[model samples]
Target: MVVKSHKIHDVEMVEALKEARQKIFTEIRKVIIGQDQVIEELLISLLARGHCLLIGVPGLAKTLLISTLAKVLRLKFNRIQFTPDLMPSDITGTEIIEDDHSTGKKVFKFVKGPVFANIVLADEINRTPPKTQAALLQAMQEHEVTAAGTTYKLKEPFFVLATQNPIEQEGTYPLPEAQLDRFMFNLWVDYPSEQEEIQIVQYTTSAYSGQPQVVLDAEDITAFQDLVRRVPVATNVVDFAVKLVRMTRPNFDQSPKFVKDWIAWGAGPRASQYLILGAKTRCILDGRPTPEIEDIRAVAKPVLRHRLVTNFNAEAEGVDTIEIIERLLEKV
Candidate 1:
């Protein structure tokens, strides 16, 4: 048997890539019982080339979802269990001393850590100290790591799927607003339904163990990303996305009355960028040639939730960011 590589420029290749994504999703469904919405949001973030912050109670299968996605995509996956004692060097690589026996000379060699993988699962991220969490900021934004005065480029399609337990606050260092802004989406995972829970238990206890099937490779994913970027958006759609982000700020004149009283800070330009990119990716996934206002509205919450800040009065009143966002959306 012989295998040949197909050129991406061929029209048939695009169809094949779409088929590959379908198969990838199907394979992921094998191990993952439910949380279809969570899976779709993760896929959008991946296609947008952006990171995600997943917040849910323990035992929601957040880690499993990320691992299953990485498995089907045939990408390298690494899980980092964030802890208070974890150091920045533990996530990023560090310089090590090495000796050249022939010349009897010692030199420093850079040892890469778990961050070198294509998909990184930052589990219980809030448990880690601030300094350790900061190590991921540059990589998530720039797709590269700088160490020992040398910059190393990460592989294409790099994604960081970070998970945090929302109920556990004690002994946990909450992520600062600045670092939270780096994520494109702040997804909230909910518990599975009774039927889904039964299926999960059956799948685990049955003899038919679910195994991930590789449906797409690195090159195919890169091509899909290019296609996602090519998805078109109308002028009004772009303006809607921009206005939606600007209206989140309390200080902005266009902001709603609720926003002015409840929100202490508004989203920045990055939120607008994420909103547009997220809509573009959603359109591509839905097989649409162009983005729509509906697509932007669907993704606005995840993109803007972390960017908006609540005032002390709002906190005292038991008002959350989501409520303020809903009001802004209604007014805008």
Candidate 2:
């Protein structure tokens, strides 16, 4: 009887998840014209409780997409435009001295910054210097920020959706390796197609104004995140993910010659962890019971792209990380 009841619950949860996915897409489509893959990856990262880094040239609607997502999710959203002169205190709140009239004394109060929001969009994150950029590291990893020696827990289901302008790097500071690894997926938001561009122009140039309806709240997001954690993974799937990550390391015995020749540093264990977790999330999001190697393959590029560091020889030879990753995928 208990087993039967559990099975029934699982079915109900799956149905609810499927419905939620459709509802989310419907709401987002009202504002966004296309970029289906980008939307799917963003949803996967959200369900997996992971942060994302969006890379694209300007005017691609990267900021718009993230803001619209926050609206659909009905989370408190904050946008921090990172600048060169921005300080760490700008992102994370600082302490201010306050006068207490009743006690006739002054007390220091910790004022929260934009980082306290449920959905934080760090627009042009690379524009900030390293000191300002590192401000997000603690919040992303620990989910808590320390201000004036007092730790404050952020709201549940916190996410940092950072954007970077790929075409312009003249005055921007490149993110450090340690900080880059914190992101689960480094999604590239490409330009729209010819037809899609026409649609965008028609929609924007017209008097059409549409707002996305709220699809999910904090509780729903928390539940889905927990559900992603509960999703089952097969042994073979886990093995495949591990093997793929291992093959990226040049020093690993299982690594190929291309990795040793073109790659300077390989993905760390976090890549393997994200691969399996992302695969499991992708499986259930597609209404499957268990993850497969194909799911892992689908998430491999985004999960491993930012983690791999290419050598100077590769650049001289016009070789990129994608080529190395594709070769590894073929061999593994």
Candidate 3:
């Protein structure tokens, strides 16, 4: 009887998740035209409770997509524009001296910055210096900020969606490998299709502004994230994910000859972890009870793209990381 009851409950949850997924896409379409893959990946990352780094050229609607999703989430969203002169205090807040008028005494007060919010958009994150960029490291990993030797806890469901302009290398501070590895999915926002581009122009040029409805609150989102973790994976699926990550290392004996020749560095254990988590999230989002090998393959590109480093020979041969990943996917 207990097993039957559990099966019924799981069925209900799966149905509810499917309905919510459709509704979210419906609402997002009002503001965002096309880029269904991008939106789906964003939802997957959120469900996995992982941070995302969006890489694209200017005017690709990366910021707009994030803000639109924020509206639907009904979470406190803070947009921080990273610039050269921006200080760490600008993001993580600082201590300021203030006079306690009642006591006529000066006291130091901690001022929270944009990082205090539930959803933080680090716009043009590469424009800022490494010192200022490093400020986010603690928050992204720890979900809390240490100010004035005092640590303050962040609100639940804290997510950072940082954007980077890939075309412009001038005057931009490249994120170090360690920092880059912190992001679970380094998503690339591509330009819209020709028809989609026309639709975008028609909507933006006119006053046909979209009003997105709030579909899921923080509590509901938190529940979904928990549900993603609860989804089960087969032993073979887990082994496949682990092996795929290990095969990326050029030094690994199991790595292919092409990988050893074209790769400088391979993905770490975190990649394997995210591959499973992302696969679980993807499976649940599709209303599947158990993750399949296809789920892992679907998420491999975004999860491993930034983690793999190609050598100069690959670059000289006009090969990109994504191509190498595709070859790895085919072979592995």
Candidate 2 C-alpha lDDT tens digits along 45-151: 98898999999988998878888999998889999999999999999998899999999899998999999999999999999988888888789999999877789
Predicted structure 1: lDDT: 0.85
The stretch of ten residues in a row with the least summed lDDT in candidate 2 is 1-10
Per-residue CA lDDT of model 3 for 160-273, tens digit only, reads: 999998888899999988899999999999889999999999999999999999888887777777777778899999999999999999999989988898899999999999
lDDT (10s digit) by residue, model 1, range 18-126: 5665786789888898898888899889888889999999988888888889888888999999999998989989999999888899988899989999999999999
TM-score of 1: 0.93
- Descending-lDDT candidate ranking: 3, 2, 1
Native-to-model Cα distance after best TM-score fit, residue 17 in candidate 1, in Å = 4.9
- In model 1, the clashing pairs are none
Worst 10 residues of 1 by lDDT: 1-10
Residue 89 in candidate 2, Cα distance off native in Å:
1.1
Off by over 4 Å in 1: 1-18
Candidate 2 off by > 4 Å: 1-8
Give candidate 1's total backbone clashes. Answer: 0
Off by over 4 Å in 3: 1-10
